[model samples]
Target: MPQVKGSKQYHMVVVPHRPVRRALIIVLLLVAAGAAVAASYYWGYHQGMTQQADAVAERDRLREEVSVLTRESEELRQQVANLRLGSEVDQQASDEMRKEVIKLEEQIAALEEDITFYRGLMAPGDNNTGLTIGALNVIGTDIPREYEYKLVVQQLATDHQVLSGYLNFNVVGRRGEQTETIPLHELSSQVDNEDIRLRFRYFQNIEGRLTLPEGFEPERIELMAQSTGSDRKTVEKKFGWLVQEL
Candidate 1:
């Protein structure tokens, strides 16, 4: 250590070597580099935390939306189930209505059959036999000429029974003379029974041609139908002749 005589100051201040100066500068630079690394580490950590928070919030929002969608799906499922149940109920009701209609139709048919049976019972004389005569028409315009007649008879009862009857035709001439009785049996051989029973009706469709004698003009014709039974009854019909020249 050199000092100046009679002075408090040192004689010469020693300068630092280049290596030491470099070492100091390296230390300062290392400290500054350490501070910069710390600051960068803190900034990066903060940024990472912020990003994590945003991701968590997004996840929660997505979960809430999923829950809402699940609830809506459940509601739609319930509605679909209700609709299916309603359809089944409607189908069952339709089936019941069809059954009721069929039952009503059967009842109506049964009633109609019963009414027909009762009507047959209330009728007179064997209850099932009936005779109907259509309109009688003369063949020609001349009097006492050949004539054609159509008759329709029906059996009201279901039983298959035959009926036998007789027809008598009386003719009156224009000159106040009466002809003999004309028997239907002489013209037809279809008589097999005397009394007509239940389900037995006689249908006499007689298409006959009769010749009149010369100089005898028929003024009126009388038809008598007689039925053989315990209580015999006869039906008579009279027809007037239209005069025409031959």
Candidate 2:
């Protein structure tokens, strides 16, 4: 080496290519690890979104079920209320109908009595208009084999004298081909005497209780009224009789 009087020298450092290769490999590994982490984060976010959507759908279904139940409950309540109101209305209607029926029954009874009274006031003087049996009704009594009967005997003439006669009641029934007759007085307690005295001017209502034998079905009733005093006029009347127990 030869040294000069005014020369300057510089020192330089040399880097190896192996260190660069190692740094590049380290950078690539970091980039790959970061990419993998990003991919995992994205997949987790999508999974969370899917799970949230499923939860929302399930909540909507539950709400729908609750709405249906509420509607059904309200409908049942309305039906129950309607049934209660309907029962009350029906009872009121039935009560009104029953009252109207009772009133009509009373009116009918009053009209019948008035008709009987008017017939007595009006009478004819001619002899052609004689005694007549106006109405006959037989009702079953409370006791067995006993019945009550009412007979309305009317006369159109009272100018001659008061009608004085005797009444005979006979129960007639069919025994095979012939008709059989049994006296009512024989089978009766209230109607003890066979001959009942009858005295009236215009009309006479003869009411008495009658009795029949056990298992006796009378087909008809024969009523005979005979004037016992001066004129001796005889009148006969018949009525249908069906035996019934109370």
Candidate 3:
């Protein structure tokens, strides 16, 4: 082998694919970051939607509960109103009853008063007996010449009837002259003479006519009556006679 120029060893410059690798790596990292961001955004949106739904459901539930409570409150209020109305009606009825009771009591009291008055009226032994003398007339000088007298006798006892007895009347003149004793039965011929019996609590009227004496003038008259009872009760009366000229 002839000695040729020394063969030089060729060292080729080898450039590595660093840029492509770096670019690929950067692209991958960017994709991964983008995916991660997208995933995070989606998760956040879903969480928001879920929270919204939950809030809506909670609001709906709250609204339902409020409606139920409102209905129950209305029912309770209605019940209270009804009870109050019932109470008022009962009070009104009680007031009416009280008024009626008062009216009835008044009526009963009035009736009782009327009954008492009637009872008093129906009581016995009411003394309603008296006597009366008619006007006396004179002939000329207004002096009494003739006189008419009426005597009324009433039985005081309402239990039994009384038989008529003799009625004695004495007329004392101004001159102290006395009249005669007259029988009551002989004075009235119209009456039944069979012992004039008067019913219980009845009045009997007896009339008599008398002529005065010519010399004496009558001024006053006195009357006395005696009942034919077992005790013989007597009644006396005095009256002034009016003397008028006829």
Candidate 4:
């Protein structure tokens, strides 16, 4: 090459014919695709994390609600149990009170009967004045074939004189299909004499424990009260053998 002054010079140079522009365009496109893929991944990750946090918070709230409900249910069960126990206690107390009331009523009835009996014995009625059999009671004991008997004889005379009499107690019943009469003295250890002596002005109660013979079913009891010597009066009474157990 020669340098010429004040004029344009033409020279020849060598250059390689390669596809540099196409390669540069391809590289730029690849870089843009990578940036797009990174952005999509980051967004997806953020969205997933938010959703997971929301799910965890919801699960905690549901657990708390379930715990509260469980506590309430337990309290309700305890209240029901206490109510049932109280009801049972009240029922037991009611039953005991009922039993006590029944016992008191029975005692009152017995006292009233005794008051009436004593009043009748002390005062004499006009037409009903005589030596008579007042009452008879037969009670059963816990031991089989054993019984206690009570007999009351009253003299209802206006004179109020001392009464001397002998009383006879007899039990009439069947011993294996045969009619039999048993004396009270033979069946009881307390009565030594066959005729029990009655020496009372107003009334006298004769009580004794007796044992019935084996297989002897008593149907009725017969009592005979007879006064001696001056005022000879005889009174007889009969009673069914209704045994009250003690």
Leading candidate by lDDT: 4
- Candidate 1, residues 83-154, lDDT tens digits: the string is 557657887656655565556555555544444433442343564254333235446534444444333333
Error of 2 at 202 (Å): 2.8
TM-score of each candidate structure, all chains considered together = 0.32, 0.51, 0.33, 0.58
Local error of candidate 4 at residue 188 (angstroms): 1.2
Error of 3 at 23 (Å): 99
Write candidate 2's Cα lDDT for 71-171 as tens digits: 55455455545655765788755665556555645554554454444433243445545566667788888887678887887665523246788888888
**How do these models rank on lDDT, best leading?**
4, 2, 1, 3
Model 1 / residue 182 / CA error / Å: 6.6
Better of 1 and 2 by TM-score: 2
Per residue, candidate 3 scores C-alpha lDDT tens digits across 24-82 of 99999999999999999999999888867765664465446555655554554555456
lDDT of 3: 0.51
Query: lDDT, candidate 2, residue 185?
Result: 76
The true-versus-predicted C-alpha distance at residue 112 of model 4, in Å, is 1.9
Q: In order, what lDDT does every prediction score?
A: 0.52, 0.69, 0.51, 0.78
lDDT value, residue 155 of candidate 3: 47
Backbone clash total, candidate 3: 0
Q: What is the lDDT of residue 49 in candidate 1?
A: 86
Q: Name the lDDT of candidate 1.
A: 0.52
- Candidate 2 worst ten-residue window by lDDT: 114-123
Candidate 2 vs candidate 3, TM-score winner: 2
Candidate 4 lDDT score at position 153: 89
